[model samples]
Target: MKAIVIGGGVIGSSIAYRMSEAGADVTLVEARRIGGGTSSTSYAWVNACEKLTSRAYFELNWAGVKSHRRLAEEFEGSNWLHRPGVVQWQGAGAEAAGFDEGDFDKLERLKEWGYPAEKIDTQTLAELEPDVDLSTFNPEGAIYYPEDGWLDGPVYAGAMVAAARQRFGLKVVYGQVTELLTRNGAAVGVKLANGETIEADTVINSSGRWANEAVGNADHELPLAPTVGLIAYTVSGDTSLRHGLRTPLVNCRPDGAGRILLRANDIDKTLPFDTEAVPSNPAAQELLDRVTQLMPALKGVHVEAVRTAIRPIPADGYSAIGPHPALSNYYVTVTHSGVTMAAFIGEGVTDEIVHGKSVSEFAEFRLSRFF
Candidate 1:
């Protein structure tokens, strides 16, 4: 079963790793090194706290943390990966009330694989992050998911790509897959921008922003629309946020530092990706100000850098994985959360391709349901 996986982002590399593991002859194709897409720019969070009511998304992300742990153990010597428990804060307004009723119970299992999290009280919250000006918020503390961790996105993507090539018998092709080769209304293989075509029985469109394009190349529509998400990090002085924090208040930034990444939760409305301007939304500065009130550290850090990126979020805004509707043999696995969830069930993608199995609840993500 020779497989050609296009795009070398986390989702692409992960799918390739999974295919090779299942004994499928895999070939990973990329225009650049792995993790070059939005995967490289993500503020990697391994938590399911954001989805209070969305059980499906919660479950998928919860599963992703376990997947990363397996990789860490499998490659024990690699420090490129590890679980860094996530601490998210909600301040002022509803977030100040702190945690939805079912939050802890829903997220408790997230720590089972050595990643443990707990809900801290206001006093504990104060101690953990003294720099946060919890004055506006009642400082009700936040939920912590210990089983969660962050990884160098590109490095992890590269590592998985390496394993697929060196450890597993997989071939990786480098070029832009400008077109999908089809015959009798079915996907056969991909034609790169360089005019190279490799025939195959299966093709997985793991391309991130270009997902819809890949499907269109096969003369089909997958109902996916491309949208952009941006992340900009600023270098700073000794600021305070140690645990990663999220707010339900006016703030959209998740505050922490390895260089505090800002404006993670809002869309850069002024700079639509299709336009290509990809501007640093001036609104981000305001969003940063709002988040700093919860974590007072912004009281003193210098603005270091702000980077912008675009990702293809699903129309339903959930990660997608399933066979192409018209062309059954072709498949797609795409999402904005690919950085977190891809590693978790990354193997499941390969399983579906190699053995025709289903792991995630697809009633919501199924490709045909949209058509």
Candidate 2:
């Protein structure tokens, strides 16, 4: 079968790699550089802890975490998958952040669900993250998720595309997909902005925030409530921080090469959709201040890069996958946790397309619900 995948972010890259590995001729088209979209700016935290809205969604995310482990084993190394674990704590009064009663209840539920979690004291927390300053917050309510980690999205996506190219001859095209091509009520392929047409037996739209645009005149619409997020990358500095940190003030993790990634839920709301990097932007400066307060080792390390992108969330705030209700040959797999679910979605979609198997896990995420 010939398959055309729109978007070259982590989800699309994974699908392309899996489809090509399954012996399907696949062509992945990207408007910009691979992994340069939301994936590049994401925190890329791989965990199901925050997905307690529904059991199915939580299970899906859990599968994603496991899939990452399996992928690392398959690749014989985890250079792109950092499993240092994550340590999160909450503060009181004005310093309060996550880990409220609701969050703690969620942690208990996760533990009951067999997910790895432990409520650690201040001493244990210090031993786990020596570089972090724990004097400001009470660590009695802190939680540690031993299985959770972060992903270097760009690196992982690039590696998958490279593996697909070297092992299965996957073709990647760099151009804006102007529209989806349909004939006789079935998706036939895609049309590029340059008027080039590439035909295929199936078309999958994994275009992140651009899913609706990629659908174009197709008889299907993907409603996305995308949100803007900003992340700051710090200059390489001296810090012994190994685990992903979620304190009352900020969320941070190592970005490899001695650098660190910092972001805050509160800061994201203050940012505009078209925010540009102006060296001393208040939002970026606030991130620097928060991280410095947490890890004094980063005192002199300045913000090197500030990236802002829209998070691709379905209208209902859940994943939307499976074939289009009206367009049988057209499929879509877009969600908010693209980093965590990429591997699982890739394998599931490939099974449905190449081997003619129905993925039961995707039954709850079908696009037909919105129609």
Candidate 3:
């Protein structure tokens, strides 16, 4: 079947890779460069621990973590994927923001569910993260997930696209898909902004923050409440932070060779959604201060860049997959935790598209609910 996959972020890249693996004639399209959207600004933390809502969602992400490990092993030479573990701590500031209870409760629940979790004291925490200044934000204890890790999203996505094209003869079309061509109430192909038209048997909309607009191209509504997040990158400094750290004030992980990525939940709200522009000067300075407070090793480091990106979240704050009732041959795959869930979703979506076999795990995330 001729399949058109929209969006070139990690999720869309994965879908294209899996589709090609399943022997489908796939054409991956991206408006901008691949992984330039939410995937680029993502924290890229590979974890199921953050899924505090649905057990199925948690399971899906947990599976994604495993899939990533296998993928890393398959591409053993790639240095972008790392499973250095992740540390999460709650502090007085988090409690003041009313985030302590839910965060702590999620940790406890994960342990009960047989997930490997460790509650470490100051001494143990120091051993795990030697460069961190415990004196700055000392806590009673912190939860550690030894299975968690992180990846460079854009790098991974670009690699996947390359693999799909090289191994499976997949074609990648670059340009904006301005409209979804339809016939007899079914999606048949896409019309690009440059006036080129390509026919396809199926169209998969994996268009991150622009998913709602992609859906609207077919004149159908896909409810998406896209939110913006600010991610600041600093030139890598001398640091012994070997693991991903998610603190009350900052969530950070290593990026590239000598760089660190920083973000905060509250900081995301200060920026506007869908703005490709860099964060304002004040926002950038505030982020740098927050990062310094969380990791003193980064004190002298300069803010290389701050990206304001719109997160791809469905209206109900859940993954929306499967074909919509109003349109035929058009499938959607969108979620808040796309980084954590991309691998599993990609493989699952491939199965559905190729063999017409729907995976049971995706039952809760289908698009039928929106109808």
**Of the candidates shown, which would achieve the greatest lDDT relative to the real structure?**
2
Q: What does candidate 2's lDDT look like per residue over 1-371, in tens digits?
A: 99999998999999999999999999999999898988998999998887777788888888888988898788866578888889877664223222354246756888888889888888887798888777755645588888789888888889889999999999999999988888989999999999999999999999999998887873577877888898889999889988998876888998988888988888887788888865477888999998999888788899988888899999998999899988879999889988999999899999999999998778789888888
- Give the RMSD in angstroms, all C-alphas superposed, for model 1: 4.0
Estimate every model's Cα lDDT from 0 to 1. 0.66, 0.86, 0.81
For candidate 2, the 10 contiguous residues with the lowest summed lDDT are: 93-102
Candidate that beats the other on TM-score, 1 or 3, i.e. the better one: 3
* TM-score leader: 2
Which residue segments of model 2 deviate by more than 4 Å? 92-99
Error of 3 at 112 (Å): 2.7
For model 3, residues 1-371, the per-residue Cα lDDT tens digits are 99999998989999999999899999998999998888887888887777757788777778777777777788758766788888888765553221254346656688877777788778888888887778754466888888788878888899889999999998999899878889998999988889899899999989977876765454576778888777888876777667888887788887767788888787677676554455445667787787787677677888888877777888988888788778899898888888877877789899898989988878888888888
Model 1, span 242-267: residue lDDT tens: 55555543322233444666554444
Q: Give the higher-TM-score candidate: 2 or 3.
A: 2
Alpha-carbon deviation at 88 in model 3, angstroms = 0.6
Instruction: Give the TM-score of each candidate.
Output: 0.84, 0.95, 0.93
> Pairing residues by index, what is the TM-score of model 3?
0.93
Number of clashes found in candidate 3? 1
